[model samples]
Target: MAVTANKIELMQIADAVAREKSIDRMIVIEAMEDALSRAARSRYGAETNVRAEIDPQTGETRLWRLMEVVETVENDSAEIALVDAQRQNPEAELGDFLSDPLPPVDFGRVAALAAKQTITQKVRDAERENQYEEFKDRQGEIISGLIKRIEYGHVIVDLGRAEAVIRRDQQIPREPLRQGDRVRAYVADVRREPRGPQIFLSRTHPQFVARLFEQEVPEVYDGVIEIKAVARDPGSRAKIGVYSNDSSIDPVGACVGMRGSRVQAVVSEIAGERIDIVPWSEDTATFIVNALAPAEVAKVVLDEEMERVEVVVAEDQLSLAIGRRGQNVRLASQLSGYEIDLMTEEEEAKKRQKEYAERSALFMEVLDVDEMIANLLVAEGFARVEEIAYVDLDEIAMIEGFDDETAQELQARAQEWLENERQALDAKRREMGVEDDLLTIEGLDLKMVVALAEEGVKTVEDLAGCVTDDLTGWTERVEGEKKHYEGMLEKYRVRPETAEAMIAEARARVGWDVEEEPAEA
Candidate 1:
């Protein structure tokens, strides 16, 4: 073995190549040895059976032939006699490992080519390993990186050696990102695809806010305070329910920090998304009330059977507790694990009255189908619709007009009405605003406009001003021309000149314009 100047320079080149390509130097050394060995074999002919070794420290090169011990060898160039193998090492047996000296010839061109190819393969493999290690443990953590560019809606985030992705659904609404601007997000998910390792990041996830709290508040990390539930309308508002093991420590106060420092940090990170940290209570009533905090709850009536809670707030607090389009109460319902029904006292009282009216209407709808049954109900002094709806059919038959067959029919019809009434009452309990009130209208009545307004549909501005989906869906529930309902919405969008004509026509309708009075002599 001899150390050549070329070998010394090749070692230096391997070091430089490893650093440039982010490959390991050991791979370059192994590949160089293989190339030199292959060159020796080609020079001496394929029968030479050559192998190569490099000095670990000095990078000296030597080539030799590896021949196995044989009983009788047909090819003497590649096989060693058993006697020779035993002489080299006494433990060597027939077909044992043995090496013979091979004549070294410089096959400069072939060796250089083989060296280049080996280096390339080794470098690629090493780079792949480096990439796997770099990104393996980064799952579920938040990363802040530069937005390199966007292809489709997926943003490439430059994270030093590699880039991660921020998918379209992961992005917050109305939040714009630009190249070079730093964006931070939670690592929502990851997968390996044909392109490479795919990483998904998010700013809208509820966990993103929860993680921010953990980072900002020491109480959360120490497990003294726990985030029980989180509901987010990302980029707008977030509600987090927090509970504390320590009785004296206020969970809400801990999250809020001194002068709102902790929460403000999270809000700032979310690009001014508001965070409301409410104290978590095991009691469903208390939890619901707290969930809708900042908007006082007058009462919370829990329905254990249906997993629902009717939340009654003050008249003025109604809008605040319900938020814009019931976003507040919706989040509260999610946080408290109950189907929430939000209303002001005025709204609830009106609902009770409406329910009483529906029950009465149900009684008449069924009994009026048969004259004999109607007479029996009337004779029972079930004069009010609710009274007939509530009274027993057996009691009706005992009086007069009802026989066994008639009584059975009346009873069956009354039960069906009662079930329908129950479903209507339940629907009213879950939703608020115009939809809740509009249910009272059986068929489209000209009086619908007035009745709706009286319940909660205050103004045209109110009627057409809600979310387009909620408004359109409400209008379709009317059992009339679909175009007429759509046209009402189209009317709302009309220009002022056209609106004037429509308003004049609407004003003439009895209840359309409350500002104008009835004509009197």
Candidate 2:
């Protein structure tokens, strides 16, 4: 009776552990079997190979020592000679594993403690693995849980099945969240570490606002309206760029809802953060204008090479456009994916006047012309000496008060100046020890060669090692600010395609595989 009861209790313990840890029952049984095997080995002899098994249905325990059938026994503890093995089983062959059954082990206090520890460690490991698997694929999702505790400015959330953390930086600034409060957050990341699975949650994530809109707006959730982009100041303000596939639907109106109910619902969830739903446009300039809502943009000048925009507003609108500490323009930049330079109309006028004067001066110096003729060239938008040297003579002739003979004279002077400049640049390039082969690149000229050598790209192989971004710069978001890294040819306004083709040609000349990649659509 006692032995039968003991076996039933063992099975019951395995079942209880599986349910408590939310693990597979078979896993718990396997862990228990391993624990028993370890305990049996301690008693039998450490060198003896032992295994344990429990019958799932009856909870009957079985322990055995494994021995190999060998032609010549090397160690009698683990091997049996073929003739000796055949005596136990007629079918036994050399190299076959034979089991030697032993009487059940009596659990001594020390052995029992070791067995318990092993079972516990195994169960805990399995539980951690299960937790990691559960949350690994749940990243970028919205989850709600009760705030269980606050540790060193981090919020520990009880997600019912597992614990997740919203680190200090992930929380909205000055947003009051207390213990026992139910909060929703974006699942920023999930990592499996030695301690366990760590699920990172964020309330201040820009996508968190989008997810909230998805919950509040039916049209957005159903895909009739799409959120094109989002930028948040977190707990203070946000902008959402929305688009509608259906022509009849107003995406911004839909997101705003009846009497502002939908937006208010989202606002309440995110600690009453103000949201501006701007209609998205395929035209970047139109989109940027829309993103800077309530602040009228009198003019927008886009620099496609740098992905930057200059926005000119009225003087009275400047403060509103810039917001407190430049927040409005900053968020607009983030939302539109363009760096914004906001200024008043007066400031823009002053800048234009300064540019006109500079251009006139440049023409006067390079073409050896008087102020009136230089001003005429500047007014005709001839900003560079290269334009005068290379542009069609008809463009200069077409300028008012300029005859074809005068246009021809200007072109001659411009060409002479450019050739002289090119010679000087070439002298500098040679002095810098730049390889002459670098000048052989189809798109690179003497000026570019000098620039490349100045930047330490002195050889054909050096140019071949370059990526397109090295010659035509790139813009990226760093800590929520748009940062522009000037490229080598950025002053020349070199297109990425031009830079890439030059690099590809250089690489091909240097014996690299330069298979042309199809342009992205």
Candidate 3:
């Protein structure tokens, strides 16, 4: 069957709209059918059940006045007597519809305008849907577009089909955007709203640096080299931890390219931001050491349980390690996923002496010892009285000038002092209305229970539900400044592993199933 010239023109219009909107041709044709149906309904009784269909192959249009077969016909427009419906189809049951084919509807002025608006709105909706589906999965991608305009510091980029906006905060600070300038950015997110899909772009995201490296360095894009971590002070400085799966390949050299070519390309893209491609390591200590590049690390003290590190450097290198306004160390901390504290060698020495003096004083007061004896104990690595009480006698006896008898006497004194302290703490705990069942947890002692009471954790269930951070606390970096927060047992020296075990033990004691740690992928 041949299509008429008018039918071919209708198909051509659907094809054109579909191509222009980047939507399916069938969607455009369906929208057209809906527009025509609405126009027909305006001419016919609005309540009448009118239906329209357009053949996809020939653009053949059909219209029908559908009336339901009923025993009693109260509405003549929408209902027909069952006997009269059987004249059209013998199988027309009470629930079925009898179709009466009507002539093609000639659109009047008002109806034509309404139909045009309906089609335009539907096509616009389809276009927005297409845009969302196209860019939703393209997040974290590098996209280039012309800077269309800037509205109150937000740079709007026309991404060919859809528009994306780089919020002021997401843009690199001090980098001005000009209209018609070509800009590349990371597709941060895509959100669907009633109007259209909101495409968010970012120039300051750490991944933007990683992506730049990906494009500049073949090794980075390939599986040979993997960029493990990235941290950026956006357009000022950045540090990335890269690792190589192949033992022969050096990740840092690969990312740097020949004669700084690869790294320089990335730096130029982000407004001359300095890039530090540190080699990633399985050892957290070694990785953090590399992260703080351009400064020699004199010493490193890692508190793995606390996820913090004390990096002591020479006085001359301290300023360089910390960088201008503490940018270097801040990026290092963020890249390494550890709270870092930088100290000069002399400062660290002074810090050590202060701690030793404090520990000596604490021992002298607690165990009824003289300053000389307490200082000796502190020198022997007895930071807490509990450590002296619980340590093996042989280890204490091995100390210079400390015989077996002396070790036994010192241990006895330590244990006696701890018992008295525990009694005082237990009394405080009872006075504070802490539950007695809290003592049933194996690792928790009387002092720890009192500390828990102070922090409002007073029951077995409370301890059971606690996370590692809940008991041991956590540290976070804000504006390049390290903020320290004390946990319930921060003074008692509770390790993260110990906290988790104690929580599990408490849960088991309270008849709750102790959960197992998840297996690594």
Candidate 4:
């Protein structure tokens, strides 16, 4: 008994394989052609230029040996003279490929094996290419699949047409997945590799929760409500910030649904992760307060220079505001994109008192005045001695305890104290090996020059290397104490703007090219 080769059966097999593999019909037909061509070449001479084609409509398979029509024949197997080519086709021209039919091949044991391998390889390659094209554009999308198997704690999911993997770390914490269970995850990434396409799925990503809400909430799906931001703690807790373009539509309420139906759906999908739905505000302060929801905020002081916010809560609300191990503040910081420092109302009051005492003490020591006089100066909003010396007499006289004569006397004392300090600083500057170039810098007085020399920064280059904090004495540390050098600029009545300008001038003079080192993390 011998196996009969049927062209119709070959076409039927190609169609079935094409449908099963989810690849193009043309790809399957091409694979069949490659296989038949390889089989024909084995039966005929290996050097023969064999080619195969199949009729997509009729399933008719044809085999041909191709020869080039050349002016003169070189190799008898590949090329034919123009006269011989024209005999077969009268319109034959030079360089034209002419085909002559070859006898259909009868499969031998080795030839059949070779043909099967060729078809399998071609079909596998086509399947891989199709899979890559199908899933590459689906990145960042929510997809559903069945868990095919688990390999070393990694879940391999069978998406209808392809397969995806969810690594152990990508799965939500403590969420157990069983084989053959239905799973939904976000398509984190798709990569094409030598073997095939690799699809990476995740359930722990912040966007995964966002996508789930989009699926469950109609307002989000229609773009009436937008997910502003999301911060997730995996299977523990999460916070979502949402906004609505239409005033009539409440984004948070829509996401929550009637009696929490929509949010419940999302929570169920993510293995019951507790979620906080916060209304997004255009104002950063309000948004931060919302992000720290269920925890009352008494006050918020923003430091735009540092991109940080000091949030003050009631003494009883401190634990709630900070959450367990500071999780509440940490998530709020992530959602709001600002660092937050949590403090109780009592703590803030104490801090204010400390600041007030520091300011009053500075005035007392600098002006050689009594504590009462320093307290009166600070109470009158005189932050620095320069303000008292240079301000209009009328403004100084407006203080409750000061008449015009008293204001004048205070100004005189301030000026005299500054002059004496400058003379002493100048003597110290000369005693130390301070360079004259440091004194030439604009806005840098003798006192600042002496301070720099004392800190071993005698040259303009050394001063340029010092950061603003060091130059201003803010970085100075006392032995066995947490007190910093209450900044030279602050102590000497130099304006912060003036100190910055002086540092810039020194840097320009020295032409120091190195960037200042960043503060330690």
Candidate 5:
């Protein structure tokens, strides 16, 4: 075959190939270098003394044979007679090697074949790397791609270089996908294998809300705003916390865009999934209020030590605040970093009334009382301890098992328990080493504590007035001890407000420091 051996012209071929394959020319040059080396191996297969070189800049090929000088030519490929060697090198002697450049063997067919194969391999490898790098960091991100095919409810999305699998479980319920239809999905995972790289996709992740934001809001990509947290129940509703680094820029506004354009774009992608964008706040109560947006909240009482929030909403907003199946409140709790308990004004009032009744009561053991006595109490509309404590002994004797002595004993035991609880609470308060203030802590559920706080004992000083006998109701043995209550108060990390409420109530009953604080001047 007719061949052209122009070094400059071959460099042009490297550039052309690099451009066509969207690859570096250096890669083409490297491939060509490797190819020519292989060709040299083929050309001088029997010639151990042969070596080859090519000009990387110009793609020129050259071959040289390192022939040994000998008195006689024993091996034609490796050795030449000293006389012949002297013709090439005048100072050549026996046992000395000589550099003899071989006339250019036409690498026309070999170089062309090698260059073609090498370039093809290099381009394929580059494409594989590019695809891997593109999808690796995109895990958990939402992307829309054409559905290339569907196999038994599993979808294959054409994500440019490769297809990602959307397993059946990860698909939205009843969302139909057809080939050539564009589908929006979450990039659940990316994995590399011997075959190639696999990108696993989904339609059911809560982060899909955030992912949709990334696609719709350019501010997120440009770093003008950031998403702090996301809580979602997919296909229903979601809450996302957003904050702006630039004070002038409202992160929520940026995400929402003009007339809800940005958020609308995301919502459209998710088939109208509702998203609530809230301003992120370090104050947990404020955050919770915002997370439960579109639901009017009247008050948020935070139990900081317990990481809980009591949210008060209007009677009309209770169902809205809680949402269907408690989803809104649940997501708000997660997003705001507080365990939320929602209540309406009416519910709160009822709850307070019940608590007040329990508070004013004397100690009574329902487990110890006979069914006949309990029925009598119920018939007399005295289902609560407060009524039982104040009930007259003459009224109690009207029932079956009560003698005068038993009635007196039951009444006295209730009074003693009530009194003892007050003293123990006062002692705990003094041990707390504080005065003029009370701690309202949560997570203290001891029956004894409840009894003591009901006695209007406000301070630890009042708690010192009671003994173990006061805390023990009619029961013979208390399951938990005083030290156990103390340990729970410390371990459960009751908020200062709850502890204060408990102390104030206790002190009021004990009649110690009865003077109310004067109004602020």
Candidate 6:
């Protein structure tokens, strides 16, 4: 090749650099133009207004001094009078740039070094931008690379186009990753920093296991089976919940493959991590039972209000259901979206007995009934005296050993007890200085009014300031004892809808300010 200082040679250099750096050709050309402009400024006095351009097709370099065509030339290097500019171009107007070509200079060592530095910096910036654009969209995807090196416990992988890093916390615990090892990880995040694009990879992410299955199982990749949820104790064990839209396909069996081949592939990739493939169910109880695999469950009791589930297993299966260090139940909880509490069948029986005794005790004390009668009421599923007072007389008479006369007597006693309780609460409400307006609120019964008065919420204004959680009993610690406020709604056992209506009515009445009484004069 002949060495020539020509436009063709300049463009060839640009094309080569662009291909090497994987950057746009025009970007490389623009960098070259900037370098040339700097060199031209050095030669034509530092104060000269210089600009440079390159032909996109021909790669020709043009260096010129730019001066504004102004009426008065204050800065000789930057501005030229209209008369002088008109000599070159008759249509020269004020504020127009008049470009004058300058002769090219021979390359000096110092100038060449400066241009090299400028070009290198520009190329580096463009390379970073290219890397960010390439990897930003790759998040949540599985990426494979060679482990380039380990810097302070972080594994830097050579991803061919750009390098990615897996921090110490992101790697599977105790996973032995050596330099030059082939590693597969999930692209967790991509951040553009001042230095370069930061690509974060993770081997411990739940999605990493999901992606591995996607690669190993054709059913998952083709959307025949959907991976509903995944929970991993990275490098130890993991659970995957899968579902299938096609009735012919078994989601769990498809994920497990024939004789566990599919799951085995994913396990091998994760360094011998065990995987439990479970079929997903729309029913929460069924899903939780499926999540706690390898153990037979006797029963599952769901507390929908608390979003918790109690799983009772045989005594012998208790340890297995809970897993080593509670790992099994924890992962099951995460996968099923419910807090799981594991217990043996014996323990559950004891708990039921304790709850039964407590409910019977509550009824006996509140309704002033004998223990035998309280037990009968508890056995009939009457947990509260309010149910007894409001229930149909025929329903109570239907109970064994209870005739119509007895039912009437029980109903009269219950009603009398409630009335007496209300009268006492009303007296307390008056003594607490509760405003009459609060008592008039439709949902504010005598019991709720008394409870609110005790809490220092005696006025409509005070009631309106309370939040829903405060209005409905909230848990707190008092004097080292865990106590619940048992707010107006909870103490009276009012329905939530009724409580909301009462609060709304109170807020509407709270708009009027309570006027202060004048002192005796």
The stretch of ten residues in a row with the least summed lDDT in candidate 2 is 512-521
lDDT of 1 by residue, 236-308 (tens): 9899999999999999998999999889999988989988888888887898888897899888788765567
Candidates 2 and 3 compared by lDDT, better number: 2
Ranking by lDDT: 2, 3, 6, 4, 1, 5
lDDT of 2: 0.91
Off by over 4 Å in 4: 1-5, 44-48, 67-100, 301-308, 344-521
| Root-mean-square deviation of Cα positions for candidate 3 versus the true structure, in angstroms | 7.3
* TM-score of each predicted structure versus truth: 0.53, 0.75, 0.75, 0.63, 0.49, 0.68
> Candidate 3, overall lDDT?
0.89
The alpha-carbon RMSD values of the candidates against the true structure, listed in the order shown, are 17.7, 7.3, 7.3, 10.9, 20.2, 10.2
Residues 1-521, model 2: lDDT tens digits = 24598788988888999999999999999999999999998898887888998899789889999999998887877888999889999999888999989899797999999999999999999999999999998998899999999999999999998999999999998999899999999999999999889999999999999888999999999999999999999989999999999999999899999999999999998888999999999999999999988898899999886688999999988988898878898899999988899988888999999999999999988888899999999898888999999999999999989899999999999999988998899889888999889988988888888888889999999888788888988899899898999999888778788999999998889888887543423
Better of 3 and 6 by TM-score: 3
Candidate 4 lDDT over residue span 331-377, tens digit each: 89989888798999889999878877998998888777789878887
Candidate 6 regions off by >4 Å? 1-4, 44-49, 66-107, 304-306, 350-521
Question: Candidate 3: misplaced stretches above 4 Å?
Answer: 1-3, 65-103, 357-521
Colliding pairs, model 4: 472-488
User: How much is the lDDT of residue 107 in candidate 6?
Assistant: 62
Please give the TM-score that candidate 6 achieves against the real structure: 0.68
Query: Clashing pairs in model 2?
Result: none
Model 4 has an lDDT value of 0.86
How far out, in Å, is residue 139 in model 6? 1.6
Task: Please give the lDDT score for candidate 1.
Answer: 0.71
lDDT of 5 by residue, 226-327 (tens): 898998776667789999989999999999999999998887776677888999987877888889988999988887767878899998999999988888
